[model samples]
Target chain A: MTTTQDRQSAGVEITPLTAPAQRTANTAFRGLSITAASLILVTLAAVATFLLVEAWPAITDASGELADKVSWIRPDEGQSLIEIAGYLIFGTVLISAIALLIATPLSIGIALFISHYAPRKLASGLGYLIDLLAAIPSVVYGLWGAIVLIPVLQPFYQWLADYLGWIPLFAPADDGTVSNTGRVALSAGIVLAIMVIPIITAVTREVFLQTPKLHEEAALAMGATRWEMVRMAVFPFGRSGIIGATMLGLGRALGETMAVYMILSVGLTYSFQILNAANHNTIASYIAGQFPEANSQGVSALIALGLALFVITLLVNMLARWIVSRRSEFSGAN
Target chain B: MSKRIDVNNLNVYYGGFLAVEDVSLSIEAKSVTAFIGPSGCGKSTFLRTLNRMHEVIPGARVEGEVLMDGVNLYDPQVDPVAVRRHVGMVFQRPNPFPTMSIEENVLAGVKLNSKRMSKSDSQDLVESSLRGANLWEEVKDRLDKPGSSLSGGQQQRLCIARAIAIKPDVLLMDEPCSALDPISTLAIEDLIQELKSEYTIVIVTHNMQQAARVSEKTAFFNIAGTGKPGKLIEMDDTTTIFSAPAEKATEDYISGRFG
Candidate 1:
């Protein structure tokens, strides 16, 4: 009878074992993955901490006075956080909301057309064209909006003021005249809509294309029309994905800097009149416009404004995630 | 509501490739007819053509006349959607819309046509359909639950309930039990026998025993080689097809000699 150690050595020689090399490689891969994941978390935490440190001066300077800190009704320049960014915050939300309202339906339609309605060759060509639009820089969009679209949309703005002035959103300015320049929140929103369409369409199209074949067939076999089939099968299946895509577009519109800065005639007034060119200013545009000329206190104030924007976007994304999770059970994507 | 089906020189094609060559057969009203064949034999394709469901696929077309009670379904004036309404289908794998509740799933076909029914009537219809599919006892208390919450076998019966709620003249099943467990398969087989009294049933099955057990008439399809279109080899009473087939291919296939 052979000893156990001698038998093991013989078995190892026969098997040609690479266990030692495999174990080393496996440990190294696990370590690398853990390091990469930790790096991301650490980087995010570092950024947040830096923002807080930069913004502390503004937050503390306005602690004693209610008027300078959080009051939207008054403007003061001496304190670091004077003139609460209420209008900037509201303008960002309103403009982005407008962009999403205009883009969501159109993006979903284009996505549906690409996935279902259009012929195969035409659909792929259209998809490539949409992706190309996404590849275009925001500055180009701004320049085009300022030069070409502003002038072209002047008459449409006049028509809205003339015919639909009873609606507060489309009403004329306080001076009883709509701005002929067309540099307004509506215009910026339209530009943002054009900017965000490709992203939403790409995402929604992917989700629509992923509708299971069996579910689609089930609808078809039930005598559903093409549109009805989309309602029953495609839309329900892609509901959460559509919501997620819309949220992504909303995020882009909220943080969009160059396009809004170049297009909108910036204003500091707290007003809800989107059609008024003299009453629009978003946080991103404010930052880009004021950063170059800002003193130390002003810089801290701007960082505070940026922090507010970061918080708002974080809240919006969290809300979107909650909605998606709530609907995941019915979505059947899993 | 059952109806006879008459096929005349049916040929199925996908894009430029022929999938099934010219074939013709008649199916009696209120009877069970099973198509038995090996894989890629186009039995499922032929079944889909009976209800105009094959046309849903891009570039999938059929050159044939599928007459249901003397009406040609392939006529240009006759809408495929209308054809599908009259001839419902059950797929191989159960696909109850996950977004819909069990009751809503049963009413899907009826609702797709935009037909208005009173709440009581709708509830009645749902109950009867589920009872018809032999699923009411298991699912009655949880009719509001998502259809996908059911087990695989129950989901298949729910699909059967959905199909029958439309009260179609004919029902097409594409290997409905192939994805089911042995016990579930037996349950569906029993349900198919009961369904034949109310609906003209056409099933495409790969299992020879299932074909013998559930079908009254049997049709066998065969292909000569790879890349060749499938053809109907023979069709006869199930007893005769399994006992003394007219074609050698059918006999060999039934006897497990060769596909």
Candidate 2:
């Protein structure tokens, strides 16, 4: 009789929480997640819009003190609009080209060492070491390049001046000081190259390791040597991945500011000799160096340059993503 | 086809553990020899030893000698790389190189070794190899497509063609049909039968029926005890092994009573 009463009581009992309450709690959590994500998206859009709005005055005004104060806004001496566009556009391209030339081959070697040559136990630890290099503060890289890399490179500069100076790219001044001017675009490029190496190497190593074992075995079975197997199977299989890695590294190199500014002593002028630091400035460093002190008109011009960087990086990243997606179709499963 | 592989007193070790022990077998020229056993029986391990491919796994080593055409494969003077060149392999899964076109994959070994040949000669070789594997017509119009873009059966066939391109004396297959569908398995089985006429074929399979169907000679392997080395129970002509195996263990395994 007592057990029966207990069972009846249990069946008829009410809970402290209802289904609606649980539903409300879950809905609130989901709504909060969406709000947080939306906030980040809206914030970025607002910043871009603000930059555009602030730069409008500089874009409209021309041939005055206000225009002179804004570096990107100021037309070249007796220059048309077309020439101004060319100079701005070419500055970004030039920096990217110089950085890629120094970075691509070195990164490939690093990737090969990490993926194929390193001992299995050692590879993971070494890969993490490379990743740690990537995480170093950009300012720290700038300081190191300015204080250490510049002075150490001076002798090489003087030797090049003595031997290969007739080649304009390698030419040195009469003093042979090898200061920021000597370090110029070439020095900035080297520094930027070092900065992007970790990124490219880490990515390429992963891609190379993903090559199918059967493909490699097939090559080896065909009387191919180890190096031959890599040439026939690994290299061809990893081509798209390598290209994508190079583009990502190139993007980072192109937009780098603090290190380039620290290594390159330059005004707004562009020139043929990359070693002539006094002549060349990239869009990023130009904006970074001048924007802090600029008035409304000056601020607007700087924002325009930033906008150009945004558009360029966006297009490059999209193209890289597309290429990777296409490669995935073949690389899936077996 | 002109040479034979003789594995004498062979034992395979992965690290310190003995995976296969005292496996002695002779594979003749232009014939199909199949190693049949249950899972984890080291049939594949014994097969890899014949081609010196067991070394590919870190810490795995083989004791005794594998004599290929009267040359000791493990001799201090012999190069394993040269051994691999002569004895081609096909994996359980089809693995065509992802970035290479169909034609390029067929020419990969020659191109990498920089073996100079006229364009017509290369073209002829590619066509013949592809036809040999029964894949020429299916892929003829799509030679420029990536090798990985093919279906599983087609990819496996492409791999077979790649193996044949080097003109290897022996072809080693490890569960080659395990990853394929029924139709694909039949296609590969037919190819194997045809392949045995030109190249010596050694296969490791879990399917006793496949061993009976495809192999001229059959080897039965079984683990001795728990955590112990696998041993060859019996080996003989395919019909004899199935009909009247000398060892009780071989009869038990073949009858599906025990493994």
Candidate 3:
């Protein structure tokens, strides 16, 4: 009912606007975004359903003893699924933990060096090199681990068993002779460490770089040395970020298949001796090794093991999220 | 513990670009001196050079002598860390370590120096430093709370407590009240009056009224034009500078003619 003059007096603009087209685009893009998001959930659901369906036979079967068919340790012929995955799960956790232990400090150090210590040019160059390392195919790492790293680390493993043999982890077996085959959990862990370093370093370097400049200046103004400034300002600010990065590395290490399979002399024992050759077999490697020739029961068993690995990784990532969220109240970025 | 600062022919540069030209001033011990100027006039840059904190920035350098208690702070043999320990700084915006507790924030400087203190001593220091910043009564019951939980004014006071905890001879505050509200600014102005009895204080302020209110001596900085280095135009008692500055530019700036 209002005239143009009335509208103008009401402080409305008279310009011709393309708002309808913008609205149409907004609605279309929103629909596309929602479809993209739903696709992820749908895919996850499909994978979970498929894994459950494929693994159903191993969960229960013809004679009620099929659950024992996927025995991880001493899987002769007839074992239940619940009892089957114990050794594989243990090996996966042990190797990943060892790898994380070795990688965490080194990755954090590299990240700090790249973020704080290096010159701008050198830092960017190093960052690019690390990104390149991450882009290398896992198969290449497998080949390198098998060919170069294993042969090179044999002497160091022997030295550990020689000098630090008093420690229970490094002690030789009852016969007092070490397994000299370079293929051991320790070697696999070291390889995994090398593989995971790039990812952890990249993530942590970004976190350290994002440290608020005011906080660093505060520490430096307080008479803190360079190292002390990093310890006080950089580390505290990056704690949750470091935890996240380590968890990412841990997830990759746990799910790694080819490199671990090729590097570790797969064994079925439930031993914790990392230095002993032919003493470990992670679920991913076990699945990759056996899936090619597996029958229906074997395939179902492997699927069941894979499902267990999926659950483990899920739990670990959830824990990392919980830790990060719990500490978010104190983190500066929050 | 307050010490006199004598800056002689100071020139500050960042990557070969002169930020501040030859300027000299003496700041008396146990008194408050304020630097007032427009933004980008290098007042804050010059303040940082007092504690050797200017060099912390990459490519930032200074050619000058900042003598405190007859010792050249810029001496090659002198460690910047030690120099900073003797002269503490509070930044414009409140920057308490977000992860630290209120009590921990107070003890941050001392802890950085790796000084071993007994539990009771640390507790005493925390209380005394907070008291010195005029924040003890407000924070006494919640010393274990995270420093970030405090209000803006309280956070600034906590930062002041942190700077004073190390028992530094001089305290440098860079626009310490620019980000604060009027009430918080008044609180800080009161605290500065109390602090001047114990520690030499150098404050850089953009508010002329604030400079007149809190400072005994005032230094006015000015720049010739864009891309030119800043220079000190006048230094005198606050009343003299506010009422009857000698330089035409100083009078023009103080009387709101031009920057």
Candidate 4:
């Protein structure tokens, strides 16, 4: 028999092993992580493959300069990928800007009432009611714009031309009917704003509700009135979150296809007035309308337009995420 | 300046539920009065009522009068904003506004409420308030840093500075040291002692030792059980309550029995 002192000096290692239960749990977690990661990779690959195949014709050699593949200078009518790319880029930016103009203030007001001012028992109910607006299908919105929204806006566009026509943005035709003659950029913008309002308001209200209680309390303790406290505490704290929410709405507006397609009639001619809805064409609407009638080369051009819209929205959302991440530090009591 | 608060049979309610039942107490001018009790015992509720903050919570209602310097705080014509302007509160957690710089946080009260203050006067008030809270030296060089960047102890001091910058006659503190380290607690305790020379101070605290350390007078509160209203069991000189005779409940609470 070995003495305890002899065993201690023997330099043999005895491993106090991890329990089998823990080892099995670890193995399960490792397997899950690998599986989840591969799923994401596979989905990304599928999207990339789709975009590359669809966009190949636009980049094919048919132009004078390599760089001309991305330019709108040469509208070959049927085979110009570069020209289609430029139009989609312009449409995405124009739609996003117009939608943001209307959505920002509307969303902030809706969020304010839902998060801070509305009666306690009614706040959530009212919020849900508003969110129901977002759930209506996009096609329904397109139909509504064509029948109701366009007709209602017709008189306003005439009034805008009569009174505010001095301004370049309103200097379009006085007749604002929804016929092919009346479809314009303004109608597409209004449709996009209405479509995005619920998303932005719902997101912003949730963000504002998550503001730390103590910060509001501190503002109250300082004798700031409800509105004053909101102006100082709530607005400052919620600014970046609101910006992110608005950008998300902007992304939705950029990709909005049905409403803009149904409401706007692109006559292949560009003009200055935003109210010239009959002549306006957005990236999504242009692609949707032209794709079915398009030859193989035209289909490629439209797909390339779709790619440009995709890239624009992607860039905006990434910028929004960066802003939102910077804002997370403000959520704490500190 | 010295000012007194007379709380006359004050009752607080959240809708139909009674929170604090019939608390009547007088806070002497220019002294620190500690309201000592266990968790959810209405000490904070009672403190909030003094500043009209109970009304800030939806459906919260107060009955009876809180007369500060002879004016009833609950009078219909009286503005709650005006009442809060005169009576500033610091909460249990240190909450410095994240958007504001350290100096701006200190001056938030005056900047938001006051119609005007001379540029020099505003600067002087910020410096003096920070000095009063004993945080001036530590933060003077970094006044432009965000208030959230401060250490926990420094943030609490910054809140104290914010409360003082408004120049309120009454300063209400709800568990101001509960979240701080002992060293920070001692610092706040020292500041409270100094503050009582100029402002009427009412503090709600769970630490009996803290009550014993800082206050001239102590109000002991107890709640029998869940759903039971909290009651003020005893109010007396700190020395008498801790060392001498009082209600048995007060003694039990002080001696570390079930509170």
Going through the candidates in order, their DockQ values are 0.80, 0.51, 0.86, 0.61
Candidate 1 lDDT at B237 equals: 99
Model 4 vs truth, CA RMSD? 5.0
Ranking by lDDT: 3, 1, 4, 2
Number of the predicted model whose TM-score against the real structure is largest: 3
Q: For candidate 4, give the docking quality class from DockQ.
A: medium
TM-score of every candidate relative to the true structure: 0.94, 0.88, 0.95, 0.90
Across A125-164, the per-residue lDDT of candidate 1 in tens digits comes to 9999999989999999999999999999989998898899
**How much of the true A–B contact set does each candidate keep?**
0.79, 0.64, 0.84, 0.66
Stretches of candidate 4 exceeding 4 Å from the true structure: A1-26, A60-81, A173-182, A267-272, A325-334, B114-121
Q: Give the per-residue Cα lDDT of candidate 4 at A148.
A: 85
lDDT (0 to 1) per candidate = 0.90, 0.80, 0.91, 0.83
Give Cα distance to truth, residue A189, candidate 4, Å.
1.3
What TM-score does each prediction get for chain A alone? 0.89, 0.77, 0.90, 0.82
Candidate 4 — which pairs collide?
A182-A278, A183-A277, A183-A278, A184-A276, A184-A277, A184-A278, A185-A277
The local lDDT score (0 to 100) that residue B107 gets in candidate 3 is 93
Q: How close to the true structure is residue B257 of candidate 3, measured as C-alpha lDDT?
A: 86
TM-score of chain A, model 1? 0.89
Q: Model 2 residue A137 lDDT?
A: 80
